[model samples]
Target: MKHFFKIVYCIAILCIADTSYAQRKTAVKAKTTTVNAGLKLPTGFHASIIARDLGVARHMAVNSKGDIYVKMDRVKNSGGIIELSNPADNGIARKKTVFGEYGGTGIAIKNGYLYASSNSNIYRYKLNADEQVEDTGKAELIVSGLLDRGQHNSKSIALDNDGNIYVNIGAYSNSCQEHDRENGSKGMDPCPILDSAGGIWQFKADKQNQTYGDGVRYATGTRNVVGLDWNNEINSLFVMQHGRDQIGTMFPQFYEAKYADEIPAEEMFLVKKGMNFGWPYCYYDPMQNKKLLAPEYGGDGKQVGRCAEMEKPVVAFPAHMAPDGLLFYTGNMFPEKYKNGAFIAFHGSWNRNVTGQEGYFVAFVPFKDGKPSGKWEVFANGFAGVSKIESTGDAKYRPCGLAQAPDGSLYVSDDNKGNIWRITYKGK
Candidate 1:
């Protein structure tokens, strides 16, 4: 009888463990199933979850045949790029292929080649007549030895019609301080880091094995640009610059803690060759609508100083929004108002502790004659799934990449869960 009782006890223990394990598995599945649960769209727009659990989906490109190639923020299972083929009319991808061994933030399809970037290198693969990559193993190295200090290390890429490829080499330090990110640290004179980084570099799109010396520093003094697009409409390049951080924490004498979150504006620039945007030495103040000298350079938070000579942003957004992807919408599926406009993906903010967090949504900037025609508006929202985001980790989804389909559908990728949302226009 004692042996039988012990056997019954063990059976009960096994049953409890099994039930607990099943509950845990179901919880994880529930999280993924809520991919587009709280996504909000504008009138005449609807969204669907085309892919999920894709492993840090970053910038993506859709080919002529509607195949999507997405770059992963990090390599998973030896694959960094994911290909989705044969998407159904219901917005579901019928086939998913994961390839490439390297990973970074930039990917684009131009001409007959598919271009992608690692943190320190740029590579291209020839596409077949079907617009699919011909050989995944033979990625040609177009640019190499770019700076990657791993602090603002995402290398976003944009290509021009003139066979030139532009890459952003982000500044590693916050403000080029003599002692990085330290309180009371003075700015480094001339900022040697800008010699190789803190700007956009241009290289030959078709050339192989090109290094820093082989490329031209197209523009200078941009702190870190993650979102950039070549405006074929205007024959120019546009970029969104992430402003500096911790003005109050680093220099409280000059800026109050409450004002730090709103002082430096995330700037949108009409980039021109040899133009200086002024980073480390200056930051844009949206309140004043002017570029102001950075605190490290001895400004009292309101002085323009040398920043008066820097190029001003065409549009300025609230500070710390973390713009990650930019796409010029030239699609016919949407209303005429959306044509030639710009869509930006804000990966959301992390450092806006005092003001709570903002910006887990995509914004649209109307363009006329290649310049912003009107004020920017939030095109998509509810990505955070919560009314208030006290911290970035509390958000359910962070919009990181933007792509437009051949049929004029807009695709937004979430880096948090690797979910891709396909948004289409459905006329009323």
Candidate 2:
């Protein structure tokens, strides 16, 4: 009887252990499924959170080996860049390593090098054959002394195939006003701010310590450009300009407060050398489909004036959406329609006080032969996790950066919560 009792007890213990293991496995699976269903994607597409709480996660880059390097908006723990490795092939970053002393917006992986930028400087690190940064402590400064006023100082960067790197030096003033953002203040003629800011500067990729004098002003009149990418298909640079704010408050006599919520379309420019997109002097109005003279420059919102000579945007988005990241899709994991298309991460709006906040999603622009072939559509949303955003603080997550993995999957980084979401498409 005692032996039989012992046998029953041992079996009971084994069953309990087995049940616990099964429960744990089920819980993990459920969590994964829940996260995958978090974002609202189109048919056959899914998303899963790979990394979380990464400290102001901004722009990101993926190497050939699928290693992800994400730049932080601010430095933390003596490092700014986070390197994630997924060895389990489960689409989650199981191992994370943080390196780099300084922090800023732009980060890209190029030919055997990882390039990153601070607000005032750009740096690069050598990569090994495994496509990992060879020395995290040893970084080579490529570009330095770029403009960094307290406002609009994100030095977003992109690299072209010809060994040239482009950096956006955003204009500090809202519209180059004599007293910035003040009502009734006239815009400065010729915009002295344009001399040192409000444009894209091109510098040599391999040249170290190159300053503004060593770089060329590739294009001008851009208010601020946080989102930019090198389009290999067109062999040119493309950028999304964050249009100036306070259209109504600054010029209430010309623009109604309601109009401020709609006019001054965020512009997508196919940038070329010496091309100007008319910043403080003019702003594009999508409803009118024309570049209208800015009220700060003495026009009542309908005059084209000197704006006729300024280059127009290839595509214009809604105002105050804050386009932060741009990635031209060249991967094959998605449908053929997505090939060579552009994905833009709108970081959401804050000052749209009249109409509540908008944006906080990734938008897709279909491209054919290097131009937008069709209308832009919402690619991924629900980052805000709410039906409407009353204020920027009400949002749960803000999509800030975008990157494509080697396997053709898309990764988006959230600045609010520091969550990195990996988006993949399954066949329909």
Candidate 3:
């Protein structure tokens, strides 16, 4: 009889423990969402608006002081780099200051200096301790007269540890050719267009008087690299390449509607000095795990070798994830496993007839000793409106920029809704 009573008590205790565990939300579930914005979150991560009611914020950078520098591509009259700061870690942004009336598409901070780039030019702003733009008032125009015909004109900036500034001068055309957007077209032989753009350029970051033409070509054949960062571990530059689009309409035989929607992988590549990833001529297919020849350059779905001249990607994701920002987590605020992982902001896909629009969230790519371990998982979601993956007609905001606070928390920006949300890990 006594033995039977002990068994009952043990069973009751076990059930109670299980119930308690199931009732709690993980640290990832603390994500806060914006009002009127089509968004949702998974079970663990939490999100909250860092700064509300802003312009079409594209790219952003945060310094050690936790001040945010945002670049908005809005009406020229009301555009430029702005500084945002809060009094405390969890405090709302209490200050906003705008400097340099000129507008740009990119912003970054390196070695105590703030750099902002226009679609066709680059500029720098002086900053003060409070993280304010020095009201020094005037921004020095570093480079001007770049090829900015609207398409792929934004120049995201990254600085290598060796005092070199790497600017992404995206190709104006989707696929480089003599005539623009023509079907059955082939890439330019010798690809002379690479000399001016469609690649990254290394410039003397300390040189105060350098111009556009003064920089050297760092890497080429990158169609459009809006997201770039220096992998301090690898001691090399890494960039996420935005693959070309309209594969089926441009070349029907190789690219079916199904293939077009999910074939060419948006690639993350380590840029070795002078290495070329054959853009306009080839694309890396994540499904097949191979570098396949592009439809425009002519080849079957499984074709290869024509793009052999190009470099390979370190990691290949779905066709249109549209990675716009890349950051390696160097802070210790998160779990130990995430120490060296990479976080990417996928802006979401717009062109695919894909009934279910994908992306519009932040993802973490786990790394082991500087190399991606396995599959990348969604770190923080809810930007897209649908609760279930199959549900459509809900997505409203598209994620665009990513910034890390001094505490290792992440800030995601969206141009679709013009709001920024700060994400922090509260997991045990």
Off by over 4 Å in 1: 1-37, 86-88
- Please list all clashing residue pairs in model 2, or write none if there are none: none
Please give, for residues 1-428, the per-residue lDDT of candidate 2 as tens digits: 99999999999999999999999989856644674546889988988898888879999999998988999988888789989895229757854678888879999988899999999999999999999998899999999999888799999999999999999999999999999998788899989999999999999999898999999999999999999999999899999999999887777778778887887899999999999999989999898999999998987989999999999999999999999999999999999999999999999998786988889999999999999999999999888877889978888899999999888999999999899999999877
Deviation in Å, model 1, residue 58 alpha carbon: 0.9
Best lDDT goes to which candidate? 2
Order the candidates by lDDT, highest first: 2, 1, 3
lDDT of 2: 0.91
TM-score of 3: 0.85
| Residue lDDT tens for model 3, 67-110 | 88878876434457667784246557654666656656678887
Q: By summed lDDT, which 10 consecutive residues of candidate 3 come out lowest?
A: 27-36
TM-score for each candidate, following the candidate numbering: 0.91, 0.91, 0.85
